[model samples]
Structure formats: C-alpha cells, structure tokens
Target chain A: MSMLQVSGASKRFGGVIANEKISLEVPEGKIIGLIGPNGSGKTTLFNSIVGYHPLDDGSIRFEGQEISHLRVPEIARLGMLRTFQQTRIYGKMTCVQNMQISKPNRNEGLMSMFDRFPKEDLARIDHLLEFVGLYSKRNLLAGDLSFGQQKLPEFAMALMNEPKLLLLDEPTAGINPTLINGLIDRLKRANEEMGITLLVIEHNMRVIMNLAEHIYCLAHGEMLAEGKPEEIQNDQRVIDAYLGAH
Target chain B: MRNTILLVLGTIIAFAVPFMFPAYQNQFAMLWLMILFALTWDLMGGQMGYNSFGNVVFFGVGMYITAVIQRDLYFDIEEYAHVAGRIDALTPDQYLTGIFLGMGVSGIVTVLVAIILGAGILGLRGHYFAICTLGLTIAAGEIASGIDYIGAGSGIVTPVFPTELMAKGMFFYFVFMVLAVGTFLTNKWMLAGRFGLAVNAIRDDEDKAEAMGIRTKRYKTMAWATSAFFLSMAGGAAGNLFGFIDPINVAFAGATFGVWMVLMAILGGKGTIWGPVIGAAIFHITQELFWTYLFGWQRVALGAMIVGIVVFFPQGIMGFLRQHWPHLFGHKVDEQTTVEQGATKESEA
Candidate 1:
C-alpha cells in the first residue's frame, strides 16, 4: 500500500482555485517529484497533505490514516513534515538549537519539556548537522547565515524529526550550484539509508530528473501528467505547459 | 561559578535593603513588584512575541479576588465598608492565613482566566492582538469599577495589617522580594529547558514553528497562563501593601503599571533572561528619583526617558551589550569571518 494517498483534493482561495481535485500517491521508500509552473497548485497540494490548512474537499491518508482535518503540528507528529520555498529558521536561535527543538516529540507534556534532553539526541543532531555540511556553523545564529546556507540547517532540522515522508518545496531554489549536488546526495541518502520517503517540488529540471524516481506534473491547478523520468521529460503536454516554456 | 557568586550577592543585597533604609522600605517593595511585572510581561511579550496590553487585567482581577476573599473571610461586608481600617483587626494567624489564601486563590483563578482569554485572543496576531488586549484591559477596568460588591468607582480599603506581627513595610518588602526572586528563578529554569527553545521558536516564525511540531498555540497559551499566575499573585500582595484596591488607578493602572511592564522589558532587552530584571531595577529607580527631584515634571522626564530608550537603545541595554561584547554572553565571535563579512557588506552597499 502507498504511504500517502490523496484523492479529490481541492483548495480555493476565494475567486482563485488554488488546487482542484488533485489526486496522487507515494508508495513507501520512493522519491517522488512534483513539477509545475508557478501557481499551478504544487504547493497547495503539499499544504493540504501536511495539513497546513483544512481541505475544502478530499481525503489525505498518510500511513493508512486520514489526516486532512488535522492541524500542522498534529500532522507533523504523525511522521510527515514539509519545508517551505522561502526557508524559515528560528533566527534568534543558534542552528544547533533550531535542530534540537525540531525533534518529533510534540506529545511530550509540560513536565517533560522541563526534563533534560537526552545526550544521545545531541549526538544525532551533530551527526545530521555534519551531514548537511553545517557542523562548523552549528553554533552561529541561524539569521546570521547567508540566505542560501539557511536551507541546509532547515533540511537537517526536518531530518531530526525522522519523518516517514519528507516534503521539500524548492530546496535548491536559493542554494548555490556548488552545494546543490551535496544537498541532492544528502536527500538521496535520507531516502535510501534512513528509509524516509521524499516528495519534492522542484522547478530545476536537472535536479528533479536526477533525483526523482517518478515525476508528477501540475498545470493551472490540475494534475497534467505522471510518468517515469524519461517519459516525463518526453511528454508533449509537459513540454508545452512547463518544460517548453523554460 | 560566577553566576552562583552573583546570585548569592544579589540575595544578600535583597534581604539587607529593608533594614538599611527603613524609610524607603515601601519603595524597595515597589521595586520588587516592578521586577515581577517586567518578568511576567516578558514571558509573553519578549519570549513568545505576543505583545499583550491587557496583562493588567489579571493584576486587577487578582487584587479584587484577594481583597474580596480577605474581607469575606473574617469581616462583614456592610460593616467593613463603613470602617475598613478602623475596626476589628485579625489576629496574626488570621491575617497570615487570609493573605496567603487570598494570594493562592487569586493566582489559580487568574490562570484559569488566562487560559480562557488566551484561547480567544491568542488566535489574533500582530497589531490586532495588541489592540484586542488593550481593549480587554480597558473593559476589565470598567467592569471592576461597576461591580458594587468589590467596591465600585470609590474602591475598597484592604483590612489593615496588625502591628503585632511586624512593621507593615518590612513584612511586605520581604514578601515582594520573595515573589520577585521566585519569578526570576522560575523564568530562568524554564528558559534553560525545551520550554525556552519552544517559545523562542514561536517568537521567530510561528508558522514554521507550528509546522515543525512545536504546538505553537499550546505553548503560547502556557506562557500567557504562567504570566497571569505571577501577575495575579503580585496584584494580591500589591493591594494589601497599598492598603487599597482602586480598579483603574491602583489595581488595573493600565496607563502606569501596564505600560511600564512593557517598557521595562524593552528597556532591559526583552528576550534575554536578565533583561527584564535589569530594566525593572533601572526604570523603577529612575522613576523614583524623577518623582523626588523633578517634582511636578516627573511625567515629562519619564516621557523623555521612554523616547531616549526607543530612539537610542531600541534593543535595550542587554542587546547593546551583546552586540559590542558577545563574549560577555558566551557568544563566540569569529573575528576573521566577521571582518570579511563586514567588508563584503560594505562593498555590496
């Protein structure tokens, strides 16, 4: 069975229909790509899946449980999490501190919050920070980092949660070319070695084609196509709508 | 080791102040009360980034709760109203019991009010939240003034403290001191743990914090409730200390205590643990001095101070210190990277 299944998902922002009856599936342990033109409901679908907002119509089943009605933190606790196109880190906090708080222990009570964090988790946090090439910068305030470098800690932060499926929106958007391959390698290792599934939204064709096992294309709030990498690359509809434009 | 030394030194000074200057015992107590106010205010305003203008509601509510409980426990309302300070003083045991019970009940009731109020008002963000809280404070003051049971516009006098126990000023000075220290230590402990990280996360970017599974709403509510708990207790003690509980001027006192709490936090550098403590001490001492020396123009001097704080020291004294001397706060600064970054920034600009 699929790890995530979204059926008949629709979201409307008043006069604008952000997403319309979008259906998709991501089986466990697979890397899925979502590619679309801007405002084509790629993000809206991700938002709906991760429960950022309630869906007007649809069912999102994550690990065989309906999750559409849940709130963001609740959905996150259920082993699914997402990152944003524009990176968001706790600016006032050190990168290490940011990673420390992002652990998936949302159900811990107020009393437990007062308890000392396990020493083992600190080791894991450092390991993940090193994985993202941020070991040296871990002690620095996240706001002081350049815009492109901020994405690395955010990725590491999501990894700290150990989510069953990770959704990344434009992870490579702000990052420089030299770091993109390293990020891709980390994302792949997170999928294969750590056993976390990935559903990515990427505008960069090279990165998507290299990373995603299967690709879904969206256009004007509708699912335009879904195929393997070469098939998606060759699809006429994808070319005319998105790829050709680029 | 250094922190421990400072803590011990601070405690000794706190205990010695009332005996050293007997005449300024009331002023010293007010100092502690001001510290309590700033600390509680910062829990929401500085830590959680919820700038509530209505925390004074809890303060006023606590004052009324404590005074009413104290009055209702040992005295008849009709007789007490007529001769509040003049007749039927409680024994030392009764006085102690009444005040402690009043404070306990007020703290609990105020926390419940905060949870209920926070559920509604915390959903509003930014300036809307601020305005809503301001409205809540004004509305609470009006409601308190209209309630005849708690002494409407004229206000009610608290039961007089029996001289048999100790000097009123000295007794309450220690009380407020304990209250303030307890608040400070409690804040320090929580901020050292996951609670601190969670609230700071909420302050930085609430949406992302929520998405990261920090339970932003619950944390926000908890912070507000904690603030309410302490402020309410302060109110209870403050009412007895002042010997009266007037809704607007004394209990609620939005324009004075309410505004001062926020100012103190900002002036101390809101988000830091020691910021509120320093801000409260400096602001309170300065205000007292202005009251003495400036006489009728104390308000003008205060206005100038507030303006100066905002214009020259927007980040507060602590923030200014941190920027110039990061090592003081144990923040490691890479001199090489900083200079390189500065050069790049200048070149870019």
Candidate 2:
C-alpha cells in the first residue's frame, strides 16, 4: 500500500489555477521525486498534501486514511510533516529548543503545557544534531546561523519527529555545492537507516536524479510526465518544459 | 542561587514599602497592578506575537462580574443599584469573603470569555487581529455604557471597604503585590516549559510552527486565555479598590490602562521573563515622578517618553542590555573558530 496517495487534487487562486487533476502516490519507504518548472504548482501540491490549504477538489489519503479535510497539525500528527522552501527555524530560540518543539506529540493539553523536556528526548535530539553536523552549535540561536547552516537544523528538526514520511521542498535550494552532497547522503541515510519515506520537490537535476528512484515532472499546473530518473532525463516533453519546444 | 536571594530580598522590599510611606499605599498598589499588566501582556504580545489591543475587555468584564457578584451576594440587587455604593452594611468578614469569591468567579468567567473571543479573533493574523481586538474593547465599553443594570453611562460603584478591616490602600497593596508575584511566578514557570517553546515558535514563524505539528490557533487562544485569567482577577481587585467602574474610563479604560500595559511590555524588553517586570517598575515610577513634578504637563511628558522609548529603545531595556552585554544574559560570544570549523565541516561532509 502507498504511504500517501493524492488523487485528482485541484487548487486555484482566484482566476489562476495553481494545480489541476494532479494524481500521485508514494509507496511506503520509498524516496519519490517531484520536479517542475516555475509556476507548475509543485509547492501548491505540497501545500495541499500537507493540508496548508484545502484543495478545491480531490482526496488525499495517508496510510489508507482520507486526509484532505484535516488541518496541518492534524495531518502532521498522523506521521506526515513538511519543511519549507525558505528555512523557518525559530530564530530567537536555541537549536536545541527548536528540536524539542518539533517532537512528535503536539502536547495539546493543559498538563502537557507544563512538561519539561525529557532526558531521553535530549539524547535523541543530540544524536540528530550530530547527524546533521550541528552538535557544536546546539546552543547558538538558530537565526545566527548562515542561510546554509540554518537548513541543517531545520532538517534535524524534522528528523527529531521520526515522521513516517517527510516532505522536503527545495531542500538544497540555497546550500553550498559541497553541502548539497552531504545533505543528499543524510536524506538517503534517513531513508535507509531510519525508514523515513521522502517526497522531495527539487529543481536541481543532479540532486533529484541522485536522490529519487522515480521522478514526476510537472508543467503548467499539470503532471507532464513521470518515470525512472534516466527516462525522465531523456523525456522530450520534460526537455520542452525546461527549454520551450520548437 | 543568587537569583533566589535577589527574589527573597525583592519580596521583603515589596512588603515593607507601603508601611514605610503609609500615605502612598494606593500608589504602591498601582505599581503592583502595572507589573501584573506588563507581565500578562507579554504572554500574548511578546511570547506568542499576537499583539492584542483589547485585553482590557477581559479586565472590564472581570470588574463588572466581581462587583455584581459582591453586591448581589448579601444585599438586594434592586436596592443596591439605587443606593449605588453608599451602603456599607457588610462586616469585615463579609467584605473579605465577597472579594475573594467574586474575584475567583471573575477569573473563571473571564477565561471562558477569552477562549470564546480568541477562538474567533485569534484566527485573524497580525495587524488585523490587533485592530479586531481594539474594536472588541471599544464595543464592550459602549455596550456596558448602554446597559442599565450595570449603571449605564454614569457607571456602577463597588461596595466600600469596611475601615475596621484595615486601611484600604494597605489591604489592596498586599493583595495586588501577591497578585503580581503570582502572575510573575506563573508566567516564569509556564515559559520554562514546552508551552513557552511552542509560543515562541509561533512568534518566530507561525506558518512553520504550524507545519511542525503545533496547533497555532490553539496555542494563541491558550495564551490569550491565560492573560485574561490574570487580568480579570487584577481587574476585580482594582474595581473594588478604586470604588468605581465607568465602562469606558475605569472598567475597560482602553485609552489608559490598555495602552499602558502594551507600552510597559515593549519598554522593558519583551520576550524575556524579567523584561516585563523591569519595564513595569521603571515605567510606573517614571510616570509617578512625572505626575508629581511635571504637574499639568504630565501627559505631555508621558507622550515624550513614549516617543523616546520608540526611537531610542525600540527593543526595550532588556533587549538593549542583551545586545550590548550578551554574556550577562548567558549568551556566549562565539569565537571566529566556530564559523571556520562549520565551513570546514561542510566541505569535508
């Protein structure tokens, strides 16, 4: 069974249709790639799948349960989480504190409000911090980190939750070329070692082709083509989307 | 350890001050109230990044509820409304019971109201939320003014404190001091926990916070409700101490008490535990000095102070201190080696 299934998802902003009749599936424990030109509604699909905004039409199922109507937090609790294109760490808080807040439990009750961070969670947090090469700066305010450095903590924060599936939007958008390889390794490690299924939206051909087993290409708010990385690389339609067809 | 010593010393000083002057007991009481105001305001405005201009609505509701509860408890409601605060038949025991019971009920009811208001109003973001809350306060004041049961237009009068108990100022001084301390400790404890982290996350980037599994609206509403709970109790005490509850001026008092709370939080360096406490003290003391020496020009002086705070200390005193002396607040000034090490690690990885 697929970990996540999106069927006939459509979204619009006034006169502009951001996504229309988009269908996709991520089988449990597989890294899937989504590639699209600018304005092809890749981000919009991520937003709708994660319940940032309601889709005008369609259904989303996660682990065999319908989730199109669930809000963001609710969707997150059911083992689906997403990271932003623009890194969004709590700038004023220390990196450790950021990790603590991203723990699985929403802690929605009055009693949970007063909960101290558990000692066990600290060990896991530290491990994740080390995994992302940020243990040395654990106490530093997240905002103080360089733009590339900030993304490391954000990735670690998502890992801290141990979500069944993680949605990464442009995970390597602003990273240095050297760091991109490290991030790709970590993403693969997270999949192989920790069993986190990934759905990544990437513009970098080299990164997505390296990271994703199967790639889906979107153009003009519709699914243009999808296949194995080499097939997608050679697809004439995708080539046309990237470099306008004659 | 040093903090505990300082806190004990501060408590001792707080308890002794009204006794030292005796005459300025009410002024001392107002000082505690101001501290409460700043502390509570920072919970939503500073920690959660929901700047509300209508928190005074909860305060006003608390005042009215307490007064109504007190009046209706012992005496006839119809007769009490007509007499309007002149009747002082209750003994010291009755007075104390009424105050405590009324304030408790006021806190609870106001929290419920806050939750209801927050559910709808907290959905609005940023300035729209702020403006909506301001409208809520103004509308509450106008509605209160129009109601006859609570003394429309003219305002209601709270029962007079029986002198046999103690001087009213000294009584309220202790009461408000306890209230302020409770507010401080409660806020400090809450902010030390997951609640604090969650709210701060919301403040930093609400959309990101939500995507990370925080129910942003829920946390926002909870913070507002907590602020309301404290403000309502303070309002109850204040109404009885002042002996009047003019809907616009005293109960709601959006133009003065409402504005002052926000200013005090901003002036002290919001988003820190000690910031609001320090801010309230400085702002209150400065206002008192201006009121005494500046005479009729006090408002003008206050206006100037507000401008000065905005211009020179936009981040407030704590923020200024944090910026200048990071070590004092436990922030380490990192050596250049760390950044270099980070770059090396990136390349190596």
Candidate 3:
C-alpha cells in the first residue's frame, strides 16, 4: 500500500499558480525522485506536501489520513518529515544535539525530554551519526561543519523523529562529489534497511538517476512525465523540460 | 574551574557586603537588585533577541501590588490593629511575610498581564514590537496612577518598623538571592534545551526556523512570560525594601530603567549566558558611583559610557574578554572556528 498519496493538489501565490493539479503516490519502502527545472513548482509542491504552504485545492493523505491543511510541526509529528534544500541545522548546537531533536515520542512535556532515553534509542542516535559519517564531529557545533557535512546533519535531524516517510529537497545541492556519493549510499541504506519511504526533489541528475526507483518530472507547475528512470530519460517532454534537449 | 570559584566568591561577597558596611551600603545593595532586574531584561531582550522597551510594566505592577498589600490594605496600622487586638503579639517577621505574600500575588498578576500582552506584541518583530510594548508600559502607568485604592499618584507610605529593620534587610537579601538564582536557572534552561536551539535559529533566521518545524510564536510568548514573572518579583521586592511606592518609581522611572537594562545587556554580550550579569554589575556599579559622587552629571556619564561601549566594544565586555582573554579567567571560550570556516565557504561559494 502507498505510504503517501496526493491527488489534485494545487497552490496559488497571489495570482501565480505555483502548483496546479499535481498528484503522486509512493509505496512503502520505495525511493521516489521528483525532478523539475527552476520555477517548475518542485519546491512549492514539497512545501505544499509538508504543510508549509496551504493547498488551494485537493488533498494529501499520509498513511491514509488527509493532511493537506495540517500545521507544519503537526504534520512532522505524524511521521512525515522534510529537509530544506538550503541547510537548516541549528548552528549553535552540536550535531548530536540536532539529531536528538528529531527523536519521536508520545510525550511532549519537558520532564519527558529530560528523562533518559532507552539504551537502544541512544545507540540508534549514535549509529545514525556514524551512518552520516558525523560521529567524530558530534561534539562540534553544527555551524562548524563543512557544507556537505552540514547537509548530512540536516538528514540526520529529519531522521531523529524516526519518520516512516521522508521528503528531501535538493539534498546534494552544494556538497562535493565525494559527500554526495556518501549521502546517496546512506539514503539507499535507510530505505532498504529501515523500510522507510522517501520522496526526493533534486536538480542533480547523477544522484537522482542512481537513487530513484520511480521518477516524476514536473515543469510549468504541472507533471510532465511519471515512470521508471529509463522511461523519464527517454521522454521527449521531460528531456525538453529538464535538460533543454536539442 | 577557576571561573566557577570566582563566581562563587563573588556571590559570597554580594551576600556579605550589606551586613558589613554602613546603612549607606544598603543603597549599593539596592543597586545589585537593579542589576538583577537588568539581567532579567537581558534574558528576553538580548539572549532571546527580542528588543523590549516595556519591561518596566511588569516591574511597576509588582511594586504597586506590593505597596497596596503592605501599606494601604493589609499591613496598614488600622488593619493590623484589629488583628493585633484579636490575636496575641504578631511579630514583625510575620507582618513582613504579608509583604512577601503581596510580592508573590503581584508577581502572578504581572505574569498574567505579560502573557496576554506578550501574546499580542511578542509576535511583532523589530521596532514595532518594541514600540508597542513601550506604549503599553506608559498606558499601564497612567492607569495605575489613577487607581486610588493603591494610593494613586500620592503613593503608599509603608510604616517604619525600626525593630524590624534587620528583618527587612535580610528579607530583601533573600528575595534578591532567589530572583538571581531563578533568573540564572531560567536562562540556563533556555540556552541548553531544544527550545533554546529553536530560539537561536529563529534569531538567526525566523523563516528558516519555521521551515524546520519550530513554533516561533509560542517560544517568543513563553520567553516573554518567563521574563515578566521574574521582573515583577524583583520589582515587588524592591518596593518592600524601599518601604514606600509611587508611580514615578514603580512605573515611569521603571520604563526608563528598562532601557538602561537593555543597554547593559548589549554592553555585556547579547546572547552569552553570563554576559548580562557582567554588564549589569559593571553598569550598576558605575551608575551608583557616578550618581553618588558626580551628582547632577550622572546621566551624562551614563550616556557617555553607553556611547563608549557601543563604539569601542561593539560585542560588549564579554565579547571583549572572549577576544583578549579566552583563557584569562579560566573559562573555556567557545571557539567559533567551524562557524567561521562555514561562513567563509559560503562566501566563496
């Protein structure tokens, strides 16, 4: 069964239609890639899905519940988490501190946060830091990390809540190639080992092509194509919209 | 470790100084309370990055309520006479508890007012929020002045209990210590928790904090309420110490004093935990020495000091200390090497 389903979703900013009639679905444990050129409503669609921007029309269902109009934090608490394209790690805090914020719990009280976590969860946090290659730098301020390293913490923070479905926006926008490769590998491992679902929006063709099991191409606030990576690469509309094909 | 020892020593001296010195020393002790009040201002203004100019509103409410209960209503000679005749000898300490109780009541009332006002004004950013709070302070002062039950502008005159002078002094001392510890703990909580991280992120960039799933408005309101609670308690304690209260001291001058507190916060180091305390101590000492010695030119001296601090030490005394003596006082300076490198890379990219 699909972990997330979007149907006839639309958003308007003033007079401009940032997203119009956009729909997609992601099965549990699958890696789905969302691609589009600049001004193609990729970020807007992500924002709409994450509840940052209110949908003007249609609905989004996460785990079979309508979440189109929920507040951002409320949506996040319900096991749907998103990372910004630009790094949003807390600069003053350590990387471990950032990850601790993402850990999910039924208790929202201050006393609960102060209560010691179970041994296994503590290990999971440490393991995730190691997974992101930031275990050594856990004590350092997140602002101290390199751009690629910073991106790793953003991913780590989103996973802290142990969300079943993750949305990543431009996960490799400004990182070096080596770090990008590491991110791709870790993301794949997370999907495979944890059985988590992912919807990623990216401009980097190499990262997207390697990671996505299914691909959706958007342009001019509309879906241009949806299929396997090979089919998307072959589609004339996608090639023209994304790569400005000859 | 050495810095921690120094802090402990400083606290001991603060507690002991009032007793060892003459009655005039109590004036200096009063100044320390002012410094504590200023530190509370910094908790909201500097550390939280909200520029508030109306902290005096809470302070004024604290004073007025304390005065009414201690002088005009409960502790008044006539009221006490009735109780004294009915109940056997009530000690002065028991009577002063009435005053402390008044302070607690006023503190709570001020918290409620602050929460409501904060809910509306704390959501505003920059100068708009500052100006709105300032307006509220002025309006509250005006309204308080007209309330005759609290003695109006004539103010309430607390009866002098010569036998209870020692008790009153100790009471103020205890009050000051409680407020100082409360302020420190609250500030520590804010700086150490996830909430503190969210606040810092919002200070750096509000939109970014929102995108990261932080409820910025809720955090701001909580900061404001917390600030108001402590600020009012300090004000109430000040009223009890003075043994009299008027609108000028409780409200009007309090508003101006709030500005001074903000200045001290900035001069100490805006976001650093101990920065405000350092700033408040230095500012209060200088203000006291100058006002005591320089007389009429004290304001001029204060203005000059503000100018000097702004021009010479833009990051304030804590920033200056961090730059020049990272290891001087035995405190570990947080090296921003990573942040510096990240900024450089961003610029290069």
Candidate 4:
C-alpha cells in the first residue's frame, strides 16, 4: 500500500487553475521526485497534499486515510509535513531555537507549556543541526544565515517533528551546485537510515535524475509523464515540454 | 552579586514608597495599577503579537462586577445603586470580607469572559483584531450605561472604604502593589518557558508556527485570557480606590487608559519583559510630575518627552541598552562578521 495516495486532486485560485485533476502516490520509505517547468502545478500538488489549502476536487489518503479536508496543523500532527519553496524559518530565532520550536509534541495544555523542556530535546536538535552541517552556527539568528544555509535548518526543523512523510519543495533551489550533492546525500540518508519517506519537488533535472528512482513530470497543471529516472530523461515530451523550457 | 543586591534594593524601595511620602499614597497606588495594565497588555501585544485596542473592556467589566458583587453580597445591590452617592455604610468587617470576596470572584468571572470573547475575537488578524477589540470596548461602555442597576448615566458611588483602620490611600496602595508584583512575576514566568517560544513563533510567522502543529489560536486565546485576568483585577482595585464606577470616565476610560497601555509598552520597548515595566514607570512618573509640578507647561513637556522617546529610542530603553551592552546581558557580539556581511552585500548590489 502507498504511504500517500492522491487521486483527482484539483485546485483553482479563482480564475487560475493551479492544479487540474492532479494525482500521484508515494509508497512508504521511498525517495520520489516531482519535476515540472514553472507554473506546472508541482508545488501546487505539494501544497494540496500537505493540506496547505483546500482542494477543489480530490482525495488525499495518507496511510490509507482520507486527508484532503484536514488543515496544515492537523496533517502535521498526523505525521506528515512539508517545507516551502521560499524558506519559512523564524528569522529572529536562533537556528537551534527554530529547530526546537518546530518539534511537535502531542501534549497540549496551557500549564504544561511552562514545564521545563527535556534535556534530550536540545541534544536531538543539536544532533540534527550537526547533520545539516550547521552545528557551529546553531546559536546564530536564522535570518543571518545565507539562503542555502537557511534551507538546511528548515529541513532539520521538519525532522524535529519526526514526520513519516516529508515533502521537499525545491530543497536545493538556491544552494551552490557543489553543495547540492551533500544535501542530496543527507536527504537520501534521512530516507534509508531514519526510515522516512520523501516526495521531493525539483527543477534541476540532473539532480533529480541522480536522486530519485522514479520521477513524475507535470506541465500546465496536469501530469505529463511518470517513469523511471532514465525513462523520464529519454521521454521526448518530458524534455520538449519541461527540460527544454528550462 | 550586584544584580541580586539591586533586585533586593528595588523591592525594598518599592515597598517603602508610600511611607516615604505619605501624601502620595494614592499616586503610588495608581502608579502600580498603571504598571499592571502595561504588563497585561504586553502579554498579547508584546508576546503573542496581537495588539488589542479594547483590553480596557476587561478592566471596565471587572470594575463594575467587583462593585456590584460587593454591594449584592450582603446588601441589596439594586437598592444600594438606586440610593446613589449615599451608601448604608457597611460595618468594617462586612466591607473587608465583601471586598476580598468580590475581587476574587470578579477575577474568575473576568477570565471566563475573556476566554469566550477571545475564542470569538482572537481569530481576527492585525488591524481587524485591533478594531474588533476597539468596537468591543465601545459597545461594552454603551451597554453598561444603558443598564439602570449599575447607575446609567450619572454613575454609582462604591462602598466607602474604612478610613478608620488606616489611611484609605495606603490600604489601596498595598493592594495595588501586591497585584502589580503578582502580574509581573506571572508574566516573567510564562515568558521564560516554551510558552514564550510559541508566542514569539506566532509573532514572527504565524503560518509557519501553525505548520509546526502549534494551535496558534489556543496559545493566542490563552495569552489573552491571562492578560484579561490581571487587567480585570487591576480594574477592580482601581474601582475600589477611586470609590466610584462611572461607565465611561473611571471604569471604561478607554481613551486614557486604552491608549496609555499601548504607548507604555511601545515606549519601554514591546516584546521584552522589562520594556512595559520601565515604560509605565517612566511615563507615569513623568505625567504625574508634569501635571502636578510643571502645571502651566505640562502639555509641552509631556509631548516633548513622548516625542523624544519615540524618535530617539524607538526600540525602548531596554532595547537601546541591549545594543550598547550586549555582554551585560550575556549576548555574544558579532559586529565584525556583520560589517563584513554588509560590505559584501554592498558589492553584490
């Protein structure tokens, strides 16, 4: 059974059709790729799947449960989370504090908020920061970090929640080309060693080919192709419509 | 060691203020009330990032509730209010017991009111929240005036304090002081924990905080209710001290107290624990001194002082001090890296 199943997902921003009958699936513990040209509905699909906005027509089943109607925080609590194309880190907070605040605890109460945070929480946050190669700058304000560096903490923050299915929206977008391989390795390790499943959105074809086993391509708010990485690379329509456009 | 001594010395001086200047007992009590208002307002404004223009609503409701409860607890409130200006004086015991019981119940009732109101209102963002709260305060004042049981237009006088036990001002002075300290300590405690992180997260980017699975509404509503609880108690204290509950003037003095609360927080520096405290102290002292001593030149000096603070120290006194003395607060300075970054940005541009 697939970890996530989206069928007939549709989203419309008034006059703009952001996603039209978009559908995809991610099996448990696999690293998958979503690729498209700009305005091709890949990010829109990610948004709809994570419950960022209500889908106009769709069913999103996570762990075989329908989740299309749920809100972001509820889906997050259900062990699914997503990062943004434009990083959404707390700028004023330290990178470590950002990592800490991003942690999802099921215990919800007013008085409980005052209890001392467990020491192990900080240790885990530091460990993740080290994994992201940001341990030295953990105490620095997140806003002070370079764009690529900010993305590292943003990814680590999603890990803080310990989500089962993680969505990466252009994770390596602004990163230096030389450092892209390192991020890809860390992401691949997160899937293999941490037992996390990843559904990634990427524009860089070479990077996705190197990272994702199976790739789905979208163009003009509709799924254009779905294939193995080499097959996607060879598909004439995928290249002419997307790779050639880039 | 030096910080501890200063803390001890500050506490001693605070407790001794009424004794040092007997005539200023009422002024001192009012000062503490101002501090209480600032502290409560900052819980949402500074901490939770919701600037409410109508927190005065809680204070106003608290005043009327406390007064009415005190009157009704032993005697007929309707009869007492109808009699107007002349109360069948309570025996000293009844007055003390009634006052304490009234305040306690009012605090609880006010908190409940805030939670319900917050559930409905905290969802509004930015100016909408501010405007909704402003509308609430206005509507409450109008509603309070129409009700005859609490004295409609002319206003109702409260049960007179027992002047025989001690100076009326001193009794109220100590009452307000305790309330002020309680509010401050409560705020300090909440802001020192995970609650503080949640609050700052809401303030920075509420959407991200929500994405992190924080029920932003829950935290916001809780912060508001906590703020309402203290503000209402402070209102109850003010009503007792002033000996009257005029719907618009004393109880719901939104124009004066409402604006002052936000101003004090901003002036002292919003978001920090000490900003509101220092702002209220500086503002209250300056306003009182100008109004009393400077008399004819009061308005000019008051305006000038506010303008000076706003323009010169926009971040508030605490923020200004933090920049110059980061080491004092244990903040590591990184000016060299910052300057290099700035130069690199210039070249990039």
Please name the candidate that would achieve the greatest lDDT relative to the true structure.
2
lDDT of 2 by residue, A40-84 (tens): 899999999999899999999999999999999888888899999
The TM-score values for the models, in the order shown, are 0.95, 0.95, 0.85, 0.92
Candidate 2 lDDT over residue span B1-349, tens digit each: 9999997998789888998989999999999999999999999999988898998898899899998888888878788766554545677888888889989999999889988887788888899999998999899999999998888898878888899889999999999998998999999898898899999999999888878887677678778988999999999999999998899999989999999999999999989898999899999999999999999999999999988988898899988998788667555633323445555766887
Per-residue accuracy of model 1 over B1-349 as CA lDDT, tens digit each: 9999997997798888899999999999999999999999999999989898999999998989999898899878887766676734777787888889999999999999999998899999889999999999888888889989988998979888887898889999998988898899889998888889999998899999889887777788889998999999989999999998888899888899999999999999999998999999999999999999999999999999999888988889898998788657655644333323534666887
Residue by residue across B1-349, what tens digits does model 4's lDDT show? Answer: 9999999999999888899999999999988988988899989988778999899998988888888877887768656755545443776787888777778887899889988898899888888999999889888888899998888876668788867768888999999999999999999988877888888889878888888788788788778888888888788778888887888887788888997898798788888899999999999998999999999999888778878877888778777786677457544433332323534666887
Candidate 1, A164: how far from true, in Å? 0.5
Worst 10 residues of 1 chain B by lDDT: B333-342
Tens-digit per-residue lDDT, B1-349, candidate 3: 9999998997898778767765645565566676676677776776667788888878878877765665544455457435433322335765567667877898788888887887778778878888887787777777778987766787665445335445456556666876877787777876676566656666655655555555567677777777888877787777766766777765556445767878788888877788887787788888888989999998899889888988987878877876577446443323223444434665887
- Could you tell me which residue pairs clash in candidate 1? none
Which wins on TM-score, candidate 1 or candidate 4? 1
Give a tens-digit lDDT track for model 4, residues A1-246. Answer: 999999999999999988888888899988899998898888889888888889999799999999999998898889998898999898767786788788785666667777656888987886787788776677677877898888998999999999999999999998998789899899998999899999999988878998898899899898889989999889999888864553
Ranking by DockQ: 2, 1, 4, 3
Question: What lDDT, from 0 to 1, does candidate 2 have?
Answer: 0.90
Question: How close is chain B to the truth by TM-score, in each candidate?
Answer: 0.93, 0.93, 0.82, 0.90
Off by over 4 Å in 4: A243-246, B1-3, B81-88, B296-304, B323-349
- Model 2 lDDT, residue B203, Cα: 91
- Model 2 stretches with alpha carbons more than 4 Å out: A106-110, B81-88, B333-349
